[model samples]
Target chain A: MNSDHHVILRVVSKALIPVIALFGFYVQFHGDFGPGGGFQAGVIMAVAIILYSLIFGIAAAMRAITPGFVRGLAALGFLLFAGVGVWALIQGGDYLDYDALLGEEPGGHHGQHLGIMLVELGVLFAVSGSLVSIFYAFAGRVSEIRDEDW
Target chain B: MLEFILERGNYWAIIGLMMIGLYIAFAATNLIKRLVGLGLFQTSIILFYISLSRIDGGTAPILYGADLESGHGDSEGVEAVAEAGHGVADAAHSGAGELVNIYSNPLPHVLMLTAIVVGVATLAVGLAIVVRIREAYGTVESDEVQEMDLSVALAEAVDEVGETQAASGAGAI
Candidate 1:
């Protein structure tokens, strides 16, 4: 459907999408060491996908990553966080106790760091999946409503 | 009042933004405008809180390599563990020479980040509701919606009145 689009828009998106995704990954992994965190990173990732959808059409976007998969990812993200907390509890530590996982580590902060990073990954999945799914819902509904209704 | 305004100009501007946003959100008829206004209102509140957290020349709440307590000595609303690495804490703990204090609060920024996420989620729900309303009502205008309800109510009332009148007329005949 987007076959007739301007060459510049496609070219720019092709170059920019990878860069945006890379930045998002950086934010996700190196958040605590730097300024940004999972939330910003998730939004950035969602924006990259959305830009792709806008340029390549919803059908193509859906083919790449289906809405059902996005919804599952959102649920999985929440579950991942909850599972981590439960694991801490099972290990005879307080809920969300990162120290319990790597108590043997020297200086102790490394364990905390690892726990935070894992939790941030959960946050990234939840935010990005929800965002993309929301976009999909809106895009799908557009055809259901007529122009005159507005 | 003049002194308050002059001394707290940033506060006054923040208040102005809040008032404008509230007016637009509550008084405007267009749904999209209301959404925009709500966004503005949220932004103003975030700005207000962020401004509250700032100190004249304070640094970030971290000390790069120095291990300090997670709490600051005297700064309120700021868990500035590493602000300037130790002068203020040393002064407070040792009760030695007085030093100039400069550390901005980091708590408000932390809180506002969560607030921003919640705000976006709320806006998404609101827009979804607006879309559904438009689908069912064919318009999103507040007045139009009210007018439609009023007309429906009037018609229902008329129907009840006519039914009662017809029953009484038949009984008299």
Candidate 2:
């Protein structure tokens, strides 16, 4: 299929995609009060990449967002989160108990926030990379038409 | 009153967009169309989050310099007022006169960022599955693919029965 190279539309998408990404960042950092947080921001960022892939080809996108690397990264992200929870268990606390990681008092809050941040990062990694992986799975398949010829 | 109408009107527009997305998802038969529907549905969610974040006339929640001008009449809409005890007063303080209840809430914007990322990932996965299915069946259309699958299944079943009969004949011989 011929690719769409509509200059105006392309230009608009180019300009808007970054703006959307920046907006996601803004939401991510400022979500304490606003309606957003890491979850929503990650999705937006993924969409931006997906749109880029759609405009360009999947191969080009894979070059930009390596499917293999991302799959590993997604696994790593989950592992990191699970690791944190396990660490808490070792610290004489229940699973995912932030306070156990740190001592009592204000330290607990700090540990909690830190734990949450790490968890959020894990979420970001798994979510964003997995999303890319999913895209690669379908987009990367070899067609049956090729098989019929063989 | 005009501002109220405009605000509400924008909300309605967002709702309309959501409905359109839902319609696309439900009405389409092609797998790609369904993916498109999913995208529309997700986009509507982003819109909903953004729309809900708008407090009438609020500025973006980023705190500028300390002199950041103060508030107007206790606007019913603007509610993120800085408490008096906290010495670090935000834009909501300074002087109530300078305030304009139009600031943007940073929270929704942040959350939407993650949501958008997730949405893209979902789209990528869905499209990838569609592509793979197309590869396997030689077609991307839903009904045709189903028809092809049914025939293939029938053929497989016949092959299994034939294999069983052949084993029985071999034993009898």
- The A-chain TM-scores of all the candidates are 0.89, 0.80
Q: Score candidate 1 by TM-score against the native.
A: 0.83
Distance from true position, residue A142, model 1, in Å? 2.5
lDDT of 1 at B23: 97
**Model 2 / residue B80 / CA error / Å:** 26
Query: Residue A46: error of model 2 in Å?
Result: 8.5
Q: What is the lDDT of residue A24 in candidate 1?
A: 98
- What TM-score does chain B get in every candidate? 0.73, 0.65
Model 2 chain A: ten consecutive residues of lowest lDDT: A101-110
> In candidate 1 chain B, what residue range of length 10 has the lowest lDDT sum?
B70-79
Candidate 1: lDDT of B32?
A: 83
Report how closely model 1 matches the true complex, as a DockQ value.
Answer: 0.24
Cα TM-score per model: 0.83, 0.55
- Model 2 misses residue A1 by how many Å? 17
After superposition on all CA atoms, what RMSD does each candidate show versus the true structure? 6.4, 9.2
